[model samples]
Target: MNNHVAPRAAGKQVFITGAAGGLGAAMARMFARHGAKVFLTDIDADAVTAVADEINRELSDTVAWAATQDVRDEAAWIERLDQAAKAMGGLSVLVNNAGIGSLGSVEQIELKEWRRVMSINVESILLGCKHALPYLREAQPASIVNISSLAAFKVDPDYAAYNTSKAAVAMLTKSVAMDCTRQKIDVRCNSVHPAFVRTGIVAPFYDALGEEEATRKLTRGIPMRRLGEPDDVAYAVLYLASDESRYVTAAELVVDGGACAI
Candidate 1:
């Protein structure tokens, strides 16, 4: 199935973080198919390169480049952005989507794990915005789509660390948006909060619950009556990254299937 959408990307360049996993890889391919030069990075070296190779193989001139780097490293952000910009010819989009998840009540979660979750979830977005802003400003009329979570808005036991991290992400997007406007950077920043998606984070848990339980019980809580797919979030990213959302910033687009509405 081809996931490309022409006129949506308009051949702009997009740099995506966490480009190896389900949602990240899907977004990379979708943007490439839409005629954008896509550059991606992940801590998983092999996975990042694999996606880049696949995209380059399919879309030769589209320019797909990947790097292995930790999102928490501030210096690495500049290095990767420079590399990606050099490879893709320019930088027009930044998707601050690299994050890790955890499931534990506040008291039960270890200090190390809590810190790690926050570092990956919150620090990554901050660093991505900090390092990518100058380039985005130069590119002019660029967009940034940050990945938050429904946990930021809803109650979920055993997810205190994750929830807190995402809450920070939500506000970070708004803060960046304000900074852009105040500084007249000509860049738009937005955040997306999605409910349970069928990604690695929840797949194993669903499997342990069996198909019937997974679908009938876990997903029954979702107003949409189903778990969100990576593509569901990818499309949201595409919209925010495109000129279609040019005037839209400092906004949070909850792609949680109305889970937060209830």
Candidate 2:
């Protein structure tokens, strides 16, 4: 993790979903370290609270708060955003980072699984962007960073549902961005597409094939020859959530280490 602290996000109030672990946890830490007040949420109540406590302990300040949330629930989105905005004075950044991965080819995948993937990965983003707009607008110069995936661009036969959901995220981000711009809202919307990173989401690969072999297999196509660290993607998100990318909206920031270049 980067130790250098910068006030890039000072005074920014950020709400992040799926912040119990992996990329979401990394993002929460990154934002808090840089002076942003973060409200972290996840379905995992215990884990999410632990993460918040850890961040506060590290910073020795009350810059992070924790809550349990089911991103798929529209009611939860409405209530949580309100609570967060009230707690932090206002909501300046919404990181739609809650998502899930699926396996099975098109014909082999079950309808229920497909629906599950769509609801959590795609619909949740819609709910978040739609409901958070008011708070974000009130806190002008806000940003919505949707965490997409390199899978949206690169296909895998067994990842039918996962691929489709992420692709939807990419386009949905653009739609939201355009709407906000046309209406002269100061909220910026963008997507971050990160390739495989060393996170809990990819733990299955490591468990099946030893870490060394899994690393080799996963990095074979990446030019960097290594799986990306959570901070790698977290940094990209920080840039978009901060004032640095004020003019950058409706853009796809790819952090795949040249995977898409091939």
Candidate 3:
């Protein structure tokens, strides 16, 4: 990586799942901009390749490489991590950001949908940590940032599967952090809970309400009076990934614009 800031991440290696999409791609650019070698992967191979290519072109650092892997597959997680370790030279950060969104009540959503969401949202984080633990232990001073949601802490009747999965993520992060501490591993694990981010998953939902109506309705519960942007959560992820949050672990960083604050 080149043109790096004079800060901690100047030479670090970071691996981000869901690299083909919104938050994941933003994270890749943010870390690369700060001089980190980023390994990118997603189920959508072409999209991830474009993201990596764009990052390399924009930064002239040649710091990103893309791979195709389904996060729901545990064996694929191991393969991807090993590949990322080789590509980035070593793995120092892992962002478990790949997840799906679903909208339905418990009675409304099919069992298959619930299972799929759990497999991707909650199970993938577990697999990522399980497979990457050895590499993180070896590297020492590593970080795992799992992308959870504000719905994890709130009751969203329309999105039971998503809410349940994110809730599991919160506890999963804590469990991983505790195990790392007990095992004498110099690793930090935390979950980020973002609310109503204006990403693809939420855009269509908002589109039905229209921009003005959606803005008013969504912010009604949030004291911050706005929906979060991808960069908003990206900054939080960067903080947790960097040494600045070295003393912070097993914590839930709520990036919900104070929605749950009230």
Candidate 4:
């Protein structure tokens, strides 16, 4: 408990996936900083542990912990979320942030690869929402933040699998949100669409396209003419997670730098 830390998320129990680095880690850090007890899970156990350790080291009291999870595994989702709920007393937020980058279009991609991409990017959302609902409702005023991508709306031929997978997430978020509301569940559901944040996720694109062309392509038609930061997305999640966005659900927050506007 840093004396200066504002407890915007005080008493919140947050479970985050793919939290070893990049956007997931950023969200974990911000949530913990705002006084949420966060369970940072990832397939990379050691890396997630390091992230939790880093956050705990900075805070006066323990606010973040780590777990290993294969988000694509439905059984793993059930077990890991139960363990996280037990550790946190209950869960108030679920950030289904684990995903991967897939290259190649429908014309070139293998069936196996498309399944792999959808399994990670889209299936994980379904599993997390399904498995975490009970605990989230118990914690009332809870939120499920799905980390979709702008590719969901601005499709590229080369990013066929990735775009399609994110599109599924986009629609899934709305479906879950509506279902929760209709059922009188206290949980909120939303998706974030961030364009090409400067995370390592873009490393593959840069390597594939070469630096100059990749940069140009990524920023093309963007009014900001710049990439976004993980914190930019995390801030949006914070607003949605807190009581401020209590009435906001079944929504998609576009964190892209106006790239989608054009």
Each candidate structure's TM-score, on Cα atoms with residue i matched to residue i, is: 0.95, 0.97, 0.95, 0.94
- Between 2 and 3, whose lDDT is larger? 2
Sort the candidates on TM-score, descending order: 2, 3, 1, 4
lDDT of 2 at 141: 97
lDDT of 2 by residue, 142-227 (tens): 99999999999999999999999999999999999999999999999999999999998789899999989999999998998899
Clashing pairs in 2: none
For candidate 4, lDDT tens digit of each residue in 1-262?
A: 5788667888889999999999999999999888889999999999999999999998967888898999999999999998998888899999999999888978899999999998899988999999999888788888998999898999789999998999999999999999999989888999999987988877877999997888888788678987888899999988888878898998999999998889
How far is 146's C-alpha from truth in model 3 (Å)? 0.4
Candidate 3 lDDT, 109-181, residue by residue in tens: 9999999999999988989999998888877789999999999998879999998999999999999999989
> All predictions: root-mean-square deviation over Cα?
2.1, 1.8, 1.9, 2.1
Assess each prediction's global lDDT (C-alpha) against the native.
0.89, 0.96, 0.90, 0.90
Q: Where does candidate 4 have its weakest 10-residue lDDT segment? A: 1-10
Please write out the lDDT profile of model 1 over residues 96-187, one tens digit for every residue: 98998898997899999999998999988999999999889989889999999888988677899998999999999999999999998779
What number of clashing residue pairs does each candidate have, in the order they appear?
Answer: 0, 0, 0, 1
Cα RMSD for candidate 3?
1.9
TM-score of 4: 0.94
Runs in model 3 lying further than 4 Å from the true structure: 1-5
* Model 3: worst 10 consecutive residues (lDDT sum): 1-10
